[model samples]
Target chain A: MVDDNTLLERRNVVKKIVDHRGNAKIITGLGSPTYDVFDAGDSHSNFYLWGGMGGTAMIGLGLAMSIPDTPIIVITGDGEQLMGLGSLASIGVQKPNNLAIVVLDNGHFGETGMQKSHTSYGINLCKIAEASKFEFFFDVVSNNDLENLIEILPPVKGPIFANIRIKSQNPPRKLPILDGVELKNRFRKNLGVEPL
Target chain B: MKVDDIQNNWEEKLFSLLLDHKIDFLPYVPDAGHAKLIALAEKNKLLKPVVLTSEEEGVAFASGSWLGNKKSVLLMQSSGVGNCINMLSILSKCNFPFVTLITMRGEFGEFNSWQIPMGQATKKTLEAMGIIVHRATHPSDVCPLVDAALYGAFSSDQQIALLLSQRLIGKKKW
Candidate 1:
């Protein structure tokens, strides 16, 4: 379990990660991760899941498989990740080299009035990823660990899973475009595809 | 062709149709009825066959595939259709094109009481969720309906559910 004292602020960590992201398509999980990614700087390439709680990781897998040469990252919260934990096993089996999943472990369901989550009690997401056979697994707790993750995430040749311990603080909501069609078309246009 | 050979040919034909439409991502939950199609997808070097843990993930995977300008198709059984209701909302709301080939169970079957409820509800449930349901009860109808579903999904950006009836795939022998 991650010690609370060693946790980093979610926004700062997200910013650092996004800053280092070089031409990688990002899929953000619902709630905080979506806000965090938008806080970093909105891009046409960022596909925010405004409501799909458990489907984020597989979406990243699909994107990774579709565009094999490009990097794909899924940034989600612990609660959301737990809801779709089965995705880890599926991802492990496919073994997509261009995919990475980063979990912001605040140990609570921030979307639901700060209710305690499984990670807060004893659920170890990094261990779960390891057991699922992720090529790289990191339980990040400090600045140096975060830096190491940012360095290794983009170019990693296999599925990489990282659970970064984050402080539990409710930042003001930063909502992106809620219309799914518009979001899809913009993302497609960014990929140089004609919008349907 | 022999009787058994003809049955296998239909499955291969469906696979070829998907390939013709440029579906590079194949996400599926294992179903006996789809075994031949799944096997063909696995052996194809150009297609990325993903084994999904649940039926719902296939929806998201297909959505992501489309967002990246690639096409995908999901394969599951009738029972698995129940697991996809909530996720189907994402497809409808987002106007994302979804194509899933479902194998019917519990219909025209002599066993497995548990599969009956979902089997009966599959078509209505998909319809309620605003998906266009297409069923193929005979071997000859398989390729054409699948072709239409694929065209509707991609060209019109519609959610299409292609249900393969038990009569077409043959009843499981107990």
Candidate 2:
């Protein structure tokens, strides 16, 4: 079985994303501990976004549509993607030029439990994207591919899906600064809504 | 225009209304009853038609799109109201506008048993969640009610519905 905690691979991709500091907004559906890494590092002017399993891609698409020419990166889980694969077709239809949808295929819902996921079916996510006319897509299962993604991803202009196979490692149940409610409130405040 | 004229040709009118309201993003799940409206949306150049797999995702997408500063509308069937409950809570808690153009099912000669429970409860459920529920019983009433629903939901920043009854579909399958 492939290791789920491919830390080096995760680090490399995160670095490439953060190093740019352009219009890239990191969107994730993983729970607090996993998504906090992106929230803490993102330096964009506005951090209006959403979180939760099975909804990141759709959220990213919404953001990308609102701000044309702004690059948005969606970090999704294998289990999450399985729950919302229909997003692929919907996003493909929109065909936002500055969207990159990356899936961390750890073969399980790591936040809740390391339960076996539908990705175990060897479902070709690349093929699924291709079927939807999403051309710039790949599966990065190694350190080399992760590095290469940085160089290769920028020039490609369209909706791209990169599935990175990860080895599962237990993340802490709690985040350092924000709980789910706080995370949601921060996003709402960024959107100019007062506290509820 | 006569009511039949509007009912027989609601697609073009619907598209015009959405554009007039400056609604840029739309999330929907395909329903035969909503076929013409969906097709019109697909053909419209100014409006973006996004097809979601389920109604709940459509709600979440519409809410997110609103947060992103784009006006959005969710189009789905009446039974989909059930699927949207949790997301509605999120919208209500956040005090964000979420508008849905629900094609009414399992009411007024609804054949499907599966659609009954939710159909019976749709308005009550929306009311319970503090969402304004507006029904368009005839095609002639659709445009004004839809516009009103959008305004009510967006201006108040609350969840609301424009329930389009099956009669508007004009398909007598029963």
Candidate 3:
């Protein structure tokens, strides 16, 4: 196992991704992934999930399909992605060109007290994405792979999938509006959709 | 009309309701009861048919589709409802408009003993989670109830599940 200090810091990973997001909307998985996104930068385009544990990627797929002109990125955790592994296969069949999913895999369930997760025990999520028919799949273990991900995020041919390795260290939580309705309405409002 | 003709007629009318209202996104897990409608949706250019790996994914997909300002419906069997319990929390919490067409199993003369528990528990389970549950016991009741569900869901932001009872769907002969 790699040392926690030696692995890439999760905060910087998020900062780089959000810094280059351009006009893309983001959907974060529940828990630490939400914190990571908010820590990077907050925007009305960010749809943060407070409790939906496993639906992050499919939501990106849905958004990409409906709003074809806009790019969609799903930033989620290894635990959340593992819960929705079947979604990769589902998204693969559609292959929506506007959607990209980046799982910030720290190899531990960060939100659940740093328990060693399946990814920690030799499970390869990028392989699952590739096998599931994601045309652009990346295993970001180094800075070059990370740069490559940012380069292709715009004008991308998805379904694109990437698994980025992060250190198993907890950062102070930074929460956005935890109210689901407000977060949802704010997100839709920014997209020029009427509040429900 | 024969029994088969009446059943087909009801299915067609419900399918037409979705088309007429421009419900462009349909996410579904294939079921015997929804087979014909799924087939029709697959062929229609106006509808984007998304095949989900599980029923819960449909809940998330529907929310995202709505966020993008599109009408989305989920189609699943009574058994699949069990998979959606937790994911459906996003709908009620966010007040996201949601409509799902659920075909009942383990009802009437059902032979599959395994499906009985979830089928019987489906309505109460959904209702417990703040979802309005409506059941269509006869072929004639299906379209009207579904139309009402679609209206309440989108216009009023109500989360509703339309249960097409096994009695309406008829017994599956093995």
Candidate 4:
């Protein structure tokens, strides 16, 4: 197992990926506290991967397919990732080159509580990625490997997976920038809103 | 094929038809009867597949996509048809243009008692919601009918259903 110091690093990996992929968008998940990152970050990314609840990857897959040639990176949690594991197979079969999924597997459902997840089963997530036919996959537990991995991640074919084993850490939480209704309105204005 | 050339058992064909029409946004809850279509749809780059945890979520996602100015479709099983009634009513009351491709179960030689109720009430329920339900029984009926549904969904600004019968799917592996 890697040392503990590197396991909990989040900002450096995010910064490296943001720096490397100039135009790539960071689509955050529901369970993750990413709005703060997006609000504070230097880069301007329009987040649209929210599927009301447990369909993060599905939204990523949809956006990836809808706009070809634009790379999409999903920063999702273990519990959130498990919500749509079927999408791994679905996205894999489609083999969208512009898609990259990074699962922050902290071994718990961190949002609601640090509850034990199926990851407690010691599931080989990289193997799951392989089963989904992702050409390149990495299960990283060290922060030192983060920057180097980001430099080499893109320009790969099909979907790429990174099961970055993170530690459960709850920093001071940020209130949701937009309430569900306001979020809907902001998303409409930002992404072009249409009727049902 | 012309939009009128659509028929049942045309799951894959309908998929290609959807691509041809440039209808990209898709939110689907897996349906046994529409398995082939869903499977084929997963491979299409033009159509984005959004798999929902439940049928209602699919509707909501599709609704969001619609608000985003993207044409969206919801693929669900007959059981999901029941789950979507409230949301579907919202779509109708708002005159929303959304296409629902429903896989019919509980009818024909359906051995699973679980599928019976949904299969029996699917069409009536859809009609009760003011949705125009089209039953596609032949393989050839799927594409054209779907085109019509898509057209109706957009032109009429209404919700439409393409109810795929069990005969279209044949037998279930499980």
| Candidate 2 lDDT by residue in tens digits, A1-115 | 4554543444445556556536465566655324534544643232323343466678778877886666777766777777778888888888888778877776666766677
Q: Which stretches of candidate 2 lie over 4 Å from their true place?
A: A1-16, A32-36, A39-52, A152-156, A173-196, B1-14, B124-130
* Tens-digit per-residue lDDT, B1-174, candidate 4: 111222434566677778877787677877655566667767767776766656765654465344444678888878888877765644653344779888777886777788798789999998998888898776777778999888877665768888877776564544
Give the per-residue lDDT digits (tens) of candidate 4, residues A41-134.
6333445333344455555565566555667677777787786676677667667787788887777777777888887668767789898898
Q: Residue by residue across A1-196, what tens digits does model 1's lDDT show?
A: 5566667999999999898889899999999999999999999999999876799998998888889899999999999999899999989998889999999999999988999999888889999999999999889999999988988868458799999999999899999889889888888999898876
Name the lDDT value of residue B21 in candidate 1: 92
TM-score of chain B only, all predictions? 0.95, 0.89, 0.95, 0.88
**Fraction of reference contacts reproduced per prediction?**
0.75, 0.37, 0.83, 0.05
Chain A vs. true chain A, TM-score per model, equals: 0.97, 0.77, 0.97, 0.81
TM-score of each: 0.96, 0.82, 0.97, 0.68
Cα RMSD (angstroms) for every candidate in the order listed:
2.3, 4.1, 2.0, 6.5
lDDT of 4 at B146: 90
lDDT of 1 by residue, B1-174 (tens): 111233358988888898999888889998888888889988998776889889999998999888888889999999999998887888987899989999998797537888999999999999999999999989889899989988989998989998999878877776
DockQ for all models: 0.77, 0.42, 0.84, 0.18
Candidate 1 residues lying further than 4 Å off, grouped into runs, are A1-5, B1-8
